[model samples]
Target: MALVFVALRVLLGGFFALTGAAKLWPLSAPESEQMKALFVQFAEVFPLKLFGYQPDPMNYQTTVGWLELLAGLLMALGPPILQEISNLFLTLLMMGAIFTLACLKECLSTCIPAIICLGLLRLLDICQSLVQTKKVGRYCRKKSVLKKPWEQRVSSCQL
Candidate 1:
Protein backbone atom coordinates (compact mmCIF):
# COMPACT_ATOMS: atom_id res chain seq x y z
CA MET A 1 0.00 0.00 0.00
CA ALA A 2 2.79 2.41 0.86
CA LEU A 3 4.52 1.47 -2.36
CA VAL A 4 1.45 2.49 -4.32
CA PHE A 5 1.50 5.97 -2.82
CA VAL A 6 5.23 6.28 -3.40
CA ALA A 7 4.89 5.39 -7.07
CA LEU A 8 2.02 7.79 -7.58
CA ARG A 9 3.93 10.55 -5.83
CA VAL A 10 6.97 10.09 -8.03
CA LEU A 11 5.02 9.86 -11.26
CA LEU A 12 2.67 12.77 -10.62
CA GLY A 13 5.26 14.94 -8.90
CA GLY A 14 7.87 14.46 -11.60
CA PHE A 15 5.40 15.21 -14.39
CA PHE A 16 4.14 18.41 -12.78
CA ALA A 17 7.64 19.52 -11.86
CA LEU A 18 8.98 19.13 -15.40
CA THR A 19 6.01 20.79 -17.10
CA GLY A 20 5.91 23.59 -14.57
CA ALA A 21 9.64 24.17 -14.86
CA ALA A 22 9.29 24.51 -18.62
CA LYS A 23 6.57 27.12 -18.24
CA LEU A 24 8.76 28.97 -15.74
CA TRP A 25 11.75 29.35 -18.02
CA PRO A 26 10.53 32.59 -19.54
CA LEU A 27 9.99 34.05 -16.12
CA SER A 28 13.38 33.02 -14.84
CA ALA A 29 15.43 34.13 -17.86
CA PRO A 30 13.59 36.82 -19.76
CA GLU A 31 16.86 37.98 -21.46
CA SER A 32 17.15 34.71 -23.35
CA GLU A 33 15.92 34.96 -26.96
CA GLN A 34 14.98 31.31 -27.03
CA MET A 35 12.83 31.66 -23.94
CA LYS A 36 11.16 34.74 -25.39
CA ALA A 37 10.38 32.90 -28.61
CA LEU A 38 8.97 29.97 -26.69
CA PHE A 39 6.74 32.29 -24.71
CA VAL A 40 5.50 34.01 -27.86
CA GLN A 41 4.69 30.72 -29.50
CA PHE A 42 2.78 29.49 -26.45
CA ALA A 43 0.92 32.79 -26.12
CA GLU A 44 -0.37 32.46 -29.69
CA VAL A 45 -1.91 29.12 -28.91
CA PHE A 46 -5.59 28.49 -28.14
CA PRO A 47 -5.76 28.19 -24.37
CA LEU A 48 -3.13 30.83 -23.64
CA LYS A 49 -4.81 33.26 -25.97
CA LEU A 50 -7.90 32.89 -23.85
CA PHE A 51 -5.78 34.31 -21.03
CA GLY A 52 -4.90 37.36 -23.16
CA TYR A 53 -1.46 35.87 -23.74
CA GLN A 54 -0.19 38.53 -26.17
CA PRO A 55 0.00 41.60 -23.98
CA ASP A 56 1.50 39.95 -20.84
CA PRO A 57 1.48 36.18 -21.14
CA MET A 58 4.59 35.65 -19.10
CA ASN A 59 2.93 36.88 -15.93
CA TYR A 60 0.00 34.55 -16.35
CA GLN A 61 2.04 31.55 -17.35
CA THR A 62 4.55 32.23 -14.62
CA THR A 63 1.79 32.36 -12.04
CA VAL A 64 0.49 28.95 -13.15
CA GLY A 65 4.00 27.57 -13.33
CA TRP A 66 4.68 28.56 -9.75
CA LEU A 67 1.48 26.89 -8.62
CA GLU A 68 2.33 23.64 -10.36
CA LEU A 69 5.93 23.59 -9.23
CA LEU A 70 5.11 24.27 -5.61
CA ALA A 71 2.20 21.86 -5.59
CA GLY A 72 4.32 19.10 -7.07
CA LEU A 73 7.12 19.66 -4.59
CA LEU A 74 4.70 19.66 -1.71
CA MET A 75 3.13 16.41 -2.87
CA ALA A 76 6.50 14.75 -3.20
CA LEU A 77 8.23 15.95 0.00
CA GLY A 78 5.83 17.58 2.41
CA PRO A 79 3.82 16.08 5.23
CA PRO A 80 0.38 14.51 4.80
CA ILE A 81 -1.36 17.79 5.63
CA LEU A 82 0.59 19.54 2.91
CA GLN A 83 -0.14 16.72 0.52
CA GLU A 84 -3.87 17.35 0.95
CA ILE A 85 -3.41 21.03 0.15
CA SER A 86 -1.27 20.22 -2.86
CA ASN A 87 -3.86 17.74 -4.07
CA LEU A 88 -6.52 20.46 -4.04
CA PHE A 89 -4.36 22.87 -6.04
CA LEU A 90 -3.27 20.21 -8.53
CA THR A 91 -6.83 19.04 -8.99
CA LEU A 92 -7.98 22.56 -9.84
CA LEU A 93 -5.07 23.09 -12.22
CA MET A 94 -5.75 19.83 -14.04
CA MET A 95 -9.46 20.63 -14.35
CA GLY A 96 -8.61 23.95 -15.97
CA ALA A 97 -6.13 22.26 -18.29
CA ILE A 98 -8.71 19.71 -19.36
CA PHE A 99 -11.25 22.44 -20.00
CA THR A 100 -8.76 24.38 -22.07
CA LEU A 101 -7.84 21.31 -24.12
CA ALA A 102 -11.50 20.57 -24.73
CA CYS A 103 -12.22 24.11 -25.91
CA LEU A 104 -9.34 23.92 -28.38
CA LYS A 105 -10.94 20.88 -30.01
CA GLU A 106 -7.68 19.06 -29.56
CA CYS A 107 -7.48 15.31 -29.52
CA LEU A 108 -8.53 13.66 -26.28
CA SER A 109 -4.96 12.45 -25.99
CA THR A 110 -3.85 15.80 -24.63
CA CYS A 111 -6.10 15.43 -21.60
CA ILE A 112 -4.43 12.25 -20.39
CA PRO A 113 -2.10 13.94 -17.90
CA ALA A 114 -4.91 15.82 -16.21
CA ILE A 115 -7.03 12.67 -16.01
CA ILE A 116 -4.19 10.70 -14.49
CA CYS A 117 -3.54 13.35 -11.85
CA LEU A 118 -7.20 13.39 -10.91
CA GLY A 119 -7.24 9.60 -10.67
CA LEU A 120 -4.17 9.61 -8.45
CA LEU A 121 -5.78 12.16 -6.17
CA ARG A 122 -8.82 9.92 -5.80
CA LEU A 123 -6.68 6.88 -5.09
CA LEU A 124 -4.74 8.68 -2.37
CA ASP A 125 -7.99 9.75 -0.76
CA ILE A 126 -9.35 6.21 -0.74
CA CYS A 127 -6.14 4.82 0.71
CA GLN A 128 -6.16 7.44 3.47
CA SER A 129 -9.75 6.62 4.42
CA LEU A 130 -9.06 2.90 4.54
CA VAL A 131 -6.09 3.41 6.82
CA GLN A 132 -8.10 5.64 9.14
CA THR A 133 -10.90 3.10 9.25
CA LYS A 134 -8.51 0.36 10.26
CA LYS A 135 -6.98 2.50 12.96
CA VAL A 136 -10.43 3.33 14.40
CA GLY A 137 -11.36 -0.35 14.42
CA ARG A 138 -8.22 -1.22 16.39
CA TYR A 139 -8.85 1.59 18.84
CA CYS A 140 -12.43 0.42 19.46
CA ARG A 141 -11.33 -3.14 20.03
CA LYS A 142 -8.72 -2.04 22.58
CA LYS A 143 -11.37 -0.27 24.68
CA SER A 144 -13.61 -3.24 25.46
CA VAL A 145 -15.50 -2.88 28.75
CA LEU A 146 -13.93 -4.37 31.93
CA LYS A 147 -16.13 -6.44 34.27
CA LYS A 148 -17.35 -4.44 37.32
CA PRO A 149 -17.65 -5.77 40.95
CA TRP A 150 -21.47 -5.23 41.02
CA GLU A 151 -21.98 -7.14 37.80
CA GLN A 152 -19.90 -10.00 39.15
CA ARG A 153 -22.04 -10.20 42.38
CA VAL A 154 -25.28 -10.17 40.36
CA SER A 155 -24.00 -13.08 38.30
CA SER A 156 -23.00 -14.94 41.50
CA CYS A 157 -26.49 -14.36 43.01
CA GLN A 158 -28.11 -15.67 39.84
CA LEU A 159 -26.03 -18.82 40.05
Candidate 2:
Protein backbone atom coordinates (compact mmCIF):
# COMPACT_ATOMS: atom_id res chain seq x y z
CA MET A 1 0.00 0.00 0.00
CA ALA A 2 2.81 2.43 0.82
CA LEU A 3 4.46 1.55 -2.47
CA VAL A 4 1.24 2.27 -4.26
CA PHE A 5 1.00 5.66 -2.57
CA VAL A 6 4.56 6.55 -3.51
CA ALA A 7 4.04 5.49 -7.10
CA LEU A 8 0.83 7.44 -7.46
CA ARG A 9 2.36 10.53 -5.86
CA VAL A 10 5.30 10.48 -8.25
CA LEU A 11 3.15 9.98 -11.29
CA LEU A 12 0.70 12.67 -10.32
CA GLY A 13 3.47 15.09 -9.42
CA GLY A 14 5.23 14.59 -12.75
CA PHE A 15 2.00 15.11 -14.63
CA PHE A 16 1.28 18.37 -12.85
CA ALA A 17 4.84 19.61 -13.21
CA LEU A 18 4.74 19.07 -16.95
CA THR A 19 1.30 20.52 -17.36
CA GLY A 20 2.14 23.55 -15.25
CA ALA A 21 5.36 24.20 -17.13
CA ALA A 22 3.43 24.09 -20.36
CA LYS A 23 1.01 26.62 -18.99
CA LEU A 24 3.89 28.88 -18.04
CA TRP A 25 5.43 28.81 -21.51
CA PRO A 26 3.93 32.14 -22.34
CA LEU A 27 5.86 33.80 -19.58
CA SER A 28 9.17 33.58 -21.40
CA ALA A 29 8.52 33.18 -25.10
CA PRO A 30 7.27 34.78 -28.27
CA GLU A 31 4.00 32.92 -27.94
CA SER A 32 2.82 35.14 -25.09
CA GLU A 33 0.20 36.94 -27.12
CA GLN A 34 -1.14 33.78 -28.65
CA MET A 35 -1.25 32.00 -25.33
CA LYS A 36 -2.92 34.97 -23.70
CA ALA A 37 -5.53 35.05 -26.43
CA LEU A 38 -6.21 31.34 -26.00
CA PHE A 39 -6.52 31.71 -22.25
CA VAL A 40 -8.83 34.69 -22.73
CA GLN A 41 -11.04 32.59 -24.90
CA PHE A 42 -10.99 29.84 -22.36
CA ALA A 43 -11.88 32.21 -19.55
CA GLU A 44 -14.70 33.63 -21.58
CA VAL A 45 -16.19 30.27 -22.44
CA PHE A 46 -15.70 28.66 -19.06
CA PRO A 47 -17.93 28.94 -15.98
CA LEU A 48 -15.81 31.69 -14.43
CA LYS A 49 -17.45 34.29 -16.63
CA LEU A 50 -20.83 33.40 -15.24
CA PHE A 51 -19.77 34.53 -11.80
CA GLY A 52 -18.85 38.11 -12.76
CA TYR A 53 -15.21 37.58 -11.73
CA GLN A 54 -13.54 37.99 -15.06
CA PRO A 55 -9.83 37.96 -14.23
CA ASP A 56 -7.04 38.88 -16.61
CA PRO A 57 -6.15 35.74 -18.48
CA MET A 58 -2.42 36.13 -17.98
CA ASN A 59 -2.80 36.50 -14.23
CA TYR A 60 -4.99 33.44 -14.06
CA GLN A 61 -2.50 31.36 -16.01
CA THR A 62 0.43 32.54 -13.93
CA THR A 63 -1.33 31.88 -10.63
CA VAL A 64 -2.55 28.45 -11.47
CA GLY A 65 0.67 27.43 -13.21
CA TRP A 66 2.95 28.46 -10.37
CA LEU A 67 0.63 26.89 -7.83
CA GLU A 68 0.64 23.64 -9.74
CA LEU A 69 4.39 23.70 -10.03
CA LEU A 70 4.93 24.30 -6.32
CA ALA A 71 2.32 21.79 -5.30
CA GLY A 72 3.77 19.17 -7.60
CA LEU A 73 7.22 19.59 -6.13
CA LEU A 74 5.88 19.34 -2.60
CA MET A 75 3.84 16.28 -3.39
CA ALA A 76 6.83 14.58 -4.92
CA LEU A 77 9.41 15.26 -2.19
CA GLY A 78 7.94 16.79 0.97
CA PRO A 79 6.87 15.12 4.21
CA PRO A 80 3.57 13.29 4.42
CA ILE A 81 1.68 16.25 5.85
CA LEU A 82 3.00 18.54 3.15
CA GLN A 83 2.18 15.94 0.52
CA GLU A 84 -1.38 15.83 1.83
CA ILE A 85 -1.62 19.61 1.71
CA SER A 86 -0.32 19.69 -1.82
CA ASN A 87 -2.74 16.95 -2.77
CA LEU A 88 -5.60 19.06 -1.45
CA PHE A 89 -4.54 22.09 -3.50
CA LEU A 90 -4.03 19.94 -6.57
CA THR A 91 -7.37 18.32 -6.02
CA LEU A 92 -9.04 21.71 -5.99
CA LEU A 93 -7.26 22.75 -9.16
CA MET A 94 -8.24 19.49 -10.84
CA MET A 95 -11.83 20.00 -9.79
CA GLY A 96 -11.82 23.42 -11.39
CA ALA A 97 -10.34 21.94 -14.54
CA ILE A 98 -13.00 19.27 -14.59
CA PHE A 99 -15.71 21.81 -14.01
CA THR A 100 -14.46 23.93 -16.89
CA LEU A 101 -14.39 20.92 -19.19
CA ALA A 102 -17.88 19.97 -18.18
CA CYS A 103 -19.13 23.47 -18.78
CA LEU A 104 -17.64 23.37 -22.27
CA LYS A 105 -19.31 20.05 -22.95
CA GLU A 106 -16.00 18.31 -23.43
CA CYS A 107 -15.86 14.54 -23.80
CA LEU A 108 -15.95 12.57 -20.59
CA SER A 109 -12.41 11.38 -21.26
CA THR A 110 -11.15 14.90 -20.71
CA CYS A 111 -12.04 14.58 -17.02
CA ILE A 112 -10.24 11.32 -16.41
CA PRO A 113 -7.01 12.83 -15.09
CA ALA A 114 -8.79 14.86 -12.47
CA ILE A 115 -10.87 11.88 -11.45
CA ILE A 116 -7.83 9.66 -11.12
CA CYS A 117 -5.97 12.24 -9.05
CA LEU A 118 -8.91 12.59 -6.73
CA GLY A 119 -9.09 8.84 -6.30
CA LEU A 120 -5.38 8.64 -5.55
CA LEU A 121 -5.66 11.40 -2.97
CA ARG A 122 -8.51 9.61 -1.23
CA LEU A 123 -6.59 6.36 -1.22
CA LEU A 124 -3.55 8.12 0.20
CA ASP A 125 -5.63 9.50 3.00
CA ILE A 126 -6.98 6.09 3.87
CA CYS A 127 -3.58 4.44 3.73
CA GLN A 128 -2.03 7.16 5.91
CA SER A 129 -4.73 6.71 8.54
CA LEU A 130 -4.18 2.96 8.58
CA VAL A 131 -0.44 3.43 8.99
CA GLN A 132 -0.93 5.90 11.83
CA THR A 133 -3.35 3.54 13.56
CA LYS A 134 -0.85 0.71 13.42
CA LYS A 135 1.86 2.94 14.84
CA VAL A 136 -0.33 3.97 17.74
CA GLY A 137 -1.26 0.39 18.52
CA ARG A 138 2.38 -0.66 18.52
CA TYR A 139 3.31 2.21 20.82
CA CYS A 140 0.55 1.27 23.24
CA ARG A 141 1.61 -2.38 23.30
CA LYS A 142 5.23 -1.47 23.93
CA LYS A 143 4.32 0.98 26.66
CA SER A 144 2.23 -1.59 28.50
CA VAL A 145 4.92 -4.23 28.28
CA LEU A 146 7.59 -1.84 29.56
CA LYS A 147 5.33 -0.59 32.37
CA LYS A 148 4.80 -4.11 33.85
CA PRO A 149 8.50 -4.75 34.60
CA TRP A 150 8.97 -1.25 36.01
CA GLU A 151 5.95 -1.64 38.27
CA GLN A 152 7.18 -5.08 39.46
CA ARG A 153 10.62 -3.69 40.29
CA VAL A 154 9.14 -0.74 42.16
CA SER A 155 6.93 -2.98 44.30
CA SER A 156 9.81 -5.33 45.12
CA CYS A 157 11.96 -2.38 46.28
CA GLN A 158 9.09 -1.08 48.44
CA LEU A 159 8.77 -4.52 50.15
Candidate 3:
Protein backbone atom coordinates (compact mmCIF):
# COMPACT_ATOMS: atom_id res chain seq x y z
CA MET A 1 0.00 0.00 0.00
CA ALA A 2 2.79 2.42 0.83
CA LEU A 3 4.59 1.49 -2.35
CA VAL A 4 1.41 2.09 -4.33
CA PHE A 5 0.99 5.48 -2.75
CA VAL A 6 4.59 6.38 -3.41
CA ALA A 7 4.33 5.34 -7.03
CA LEU A 8 1.15 7.31 -7.52
CA ARG A 9 2.64 10.39 -5.94
CA VAL A 10 5.82 10.24 -7.98
CA LEU A 11 4.04 9.59 -11.24
CA LEU A 12 1.48 12.33 -10.71
CA GLY A 13 4.02 14.82 -9.45
CA GLY A 14 6.37 14.28 -12.33
CA PHE A 15 3.57 14.39 -14.88
CA PHE A 16 2.15 17.66 -13.62
CA ALA A 17 5.53 19.27 -13.18
CA LEU A 18 6.49 18.44 -16.73
CA THR A 19 3.18 19.64 -18.07
CA GLY A 20 3.39 22.93 -16.19
CA ALA A 21 6.93 23.53 -17.36
CA ALA A 22 5.92 22.80 -20.91
CA LYS A 23 3.20 25.41 -20.69
CA LEU A 24 5.76 27.95 -19.49
CA TRP A 25 8.00 27.45 -22.49
CA PRO A 26 8.25 30.43 -24.83
CA LEU A 27 8.48 28.09 -27.79
CA SER A 28 5.01 26.83 -26.89
CA ALA A 29 3.47 30.27 -27.45
CA PRO A 30 0.84 28.97 -29.82
CA GLU A 31 -0.34 26.32 -27.39
CA SER A 32 -0.27 28.79 -24.53
CA GLU A 33 -2.30 31.29 -26.56
CA GLN A 34 -4.88 28.65 -27.24
CA MET A 35 -5.08 27.90 -23.53
CA LYS A 36 -5.42 31.61 -22.76
CA ALA A 37 -8.30 31.99 -25.19
CA LEU A 38 -9.99 29.02 -23.59
CA PHE A 39 -9.57 30.57 -20.15
CA VAL A 40 -11.06 33.83 -21.38
CA GLN A 41 -14.07 32.01 -22.68
CA PHE A 42 -14.39 30.12 -19.39
CA ALA A 43 -14.21 33.33 -17.39
CA GLU A 44 -16.98 34.78 -19.52
CA VAL A 45 -19.21 31.94 -18.47
CA PHE A 46 -19.11 33.36 -14.97
CA PRO A 47 -19.72 36.92 -13.68
CA LEU A 48 -16.09 37.91 -14.16
CA LYS A 49 -17.01 40.14 -17.06
CA LEU A 50 -19.13 42.40 -14.85
CA PHE A 51 -16.28 43.02 -12.42
CA GLY A 52 -14.17 44.81 -15.08
CA TYR A 53 -11.38 42.49 -14.06
CA GLN A 54 -10.94 40.59 -17.22
CA PRO A 55 -7.89 38.49 -16.42
CA ASP A 56 -5.13 38.90 -18.96
CA PRO A 57 -5.30 35.66 -20.91
CA MET A 58 -1.56 35.02 -20.94
CA ASN A 59 -1.26 35.89 -17.29
CA TYR A 60 -4.04 33.51 -16.42
CA GLN A 61 -2.33 30.67 -18.25
CA THR A 62 1.00 31.41 -16.59
CA THR A 63 -0.62 31.55 -13.17
CA VAL A 64 -2.37 28.25 -13.72
CA GLY A 65 0.89 26.70 -14.88
CA TRP A 66 2.69 27.87 -11.77
CA LEU A 67 -0.15 26.54 -9.60
CA GLU A 68 0.11 23.14 -11.21
CA LEU A 69 3.82 23.08 -10.60
CA LEU A 70 3.37 23.94 -6.95
CA ALA A 71 0.64 21.39 -6.46
CA GLY A 72 2.79 18.74 -8.09
CA LEU A 73 5.63 19.49 -5.74
CA LEU A 74 3.33 19.26 -2.73
CA MET A 75 2.02 15.90 -3.84
CA ALA A 76 5.54 14.58 -4.34
CA LEU A 77 6.33 15.31 -0.71
CA GLY A 78 3.92 12.56 0.50
CA PRO A 79 2.16 14.44 3.28
CA PRO A 80 -1.19 12.71 3.49
CA ILE A 81 -3.23 15.75 4.48
CA LEU A 82 -1.39 17.98 2.03
CA GLN A 83 -1.66 15.37 -0.67
CA GLU A 84 -5.43 15.22 -0.23
CA ILE A 85 -5.74 18.99 -0.39
CA SER A 86 -3.49 19.21 -3.44
CA ASN A 87 -5.45 16.41 -5.08
CA LEU A 88 -8.67 18.36 -4.65
CA PHE A 89 -7.00 21.47 -6.00
CA LEU A 90 -5.67 19.64 -9.03
CA THR A 91 -9.06 18.06 -9.61
CA LEU A 92 -10.72 21.45 -9.61
CA LEU A 93 -8.05 22.74 -11.96
CA MET A 94 -8.72 19.90 -14.34
CA MET A 95 -12.44 20.52 -14.10
CA GLY A 96 -11.84 24.08 -15.14
CA ALA A 97 -9.73 22.92 -18.04
CA ILE A 98 -12.41 20.49 -19.13
CA PHE A 99 -15.08 23.16 -18.93
CA THR A 100 -12.98 25.58 -20.92
CA LEU A 101 -12.29 23.01 -23.61
CA ALA A 102 -15.94 22.09 -23.81
CA CYS A 103 -16.93 25.71 -24.13
CA LEU A 104 -14.53 25.99 -27.05
CA LYS A 105 -15.94 22.88 -28.67
CA GLU A 106 -12.49 21.31 -28.57
CA CYS A 107 -11.69 17.62 -28.69
CA LEU A 108 -10.67 15.75 -25.56
CA SER A 109 -7.21 14.85 -26.85
CA THR A 110 -5.36 17.73 -25.25
CA CYS A 111 -7.16 17.61 -21.93
CA ILE A 112 -7.21 13.85 -21.52
CA PRO A 113 -3.88 13.74 -19.69
CA ALA A 114 -5.06 16.22 -17.09
CA ILE A 115 -8.28 14.26 -16.68
CA ILE A 116 -6.31 11.07 -16.17
CA CYS A 117 -3.99 12.74 -13.66
CA LEU A 118 -6.99 13.97 -11.67
CA GLY A 119 -8.55 10.50 -11.71
CA LEU A 120 -5.29 8.96 -10.54
CA LEU A 121 -5.06 11.42 -7.68
CA ARG A 122 -8.61 10.59 -6.62
CA LEU A 123 -7.85 6.88 -6.74
CA LEU A 124 -4.68 7.31 -4.74
CA ASP A 125 -6.58 9.28 -2.10
CA ILE A 126 -9.19 6.53 -1.76
CA CYS A 127 -6.55 3.84 -1.48
CA GLN A 128 -4.61 5.82 1.10
CA SER A 129 -7.77 6.27 3.18
CA LEU A 130 -8.54 2.58 3.02
CA VAL A 131 -5.02 1.68 4.04
CA GLN A 132 -5.08 4.01 7.00
CA THR A 133 -8.41 2.61 8.14
CA LYS A 134 -7.06 -0.92 7.94
CA LYS A 135 -3.99 0.05 9.95
CA VAL A 136 -6.10 1.66 12.67
CA GLY A 137 -8.36 -1.41 12.82
CA ARG A 138 -5.36 -3.66 13.19
CA TYR A 139 -3.90 -1.50 15.95
CA CYS A 140 -7.17 -1.55 17.85
CA ARG A 141 -7.47 -5.29 17.47
CA LYS A 142 -3.96 -5.80 18.82
CA LYS A 143 -4.70 -3.52 21.75
CA SER A 144 -7.88 -5.44 22.56
CA VAL A 145 -6.05 -8.78 22.42
CA LEU A 146 -3.38 -7.55 24.80
CA LYS A 147 -5.95 -6.29 27.32
CA LYS A 148 -8.47 -9.14 27.18
CA PRO A 149 -6.59 -11.72 29.31
CA TRP A 150 -5.68 -9.19 31.99
CA GLU A 151 -9.28 -7.95 32.04
CA GLN A 152 -10.58 -11.50 32.42
CA ARG A 153 -8.19 -12.24 35.28
CA VAL A 154 -9.20 -9.08 37.11
CA SER A 155 -12.89 -9.98 36.78
CA SER A 156 -12.25 -13.51 38.01
CA CYS A 157 -10.47 -12.26 41.15
CA GLN A 158 -13.36 -9.93 41.89
CA LEU A 159 -15.71 -12.94 41.66
User: What CA RMSD would you report for each candidate?
Assistant: 5.4, 4.6, 4.0
Off by over 4 Å in 1: 26-56, 146-159
Writing each residue's lDDT as its tens digit, candidate 2 over 41-137 gives 6576656677777778888888888998888888888898898898889888877877876777878887787788777767776777798999998
lDDT of 3 by residue, 73-159 (tens): 788875778877877888888877776666667677977875787688788778878888998988787544355888989988999
The segments of candidate 2 whose C-alpha lies over 4 angstroms from its true place after superposition are 26-38, 45-51, 140-159
Model 3: lDDT equals 0.75
TM-score of each: 0.69, 0.73, 0.72
Q: Which wins on lDDT, candidate 1 or candidate 2?
A: 2
lDDT of 2 at 95: 76
Candidate 2: residue 140 Cα off by (Å): 4.4
The order by descending lDDT is 2, 3, 1
Query: Global lDDT of each model?
Result: 0.73, 0.79, 0.75
Per-residue lDDT value at 80 in model 2: 83
Best by lDDT: 2
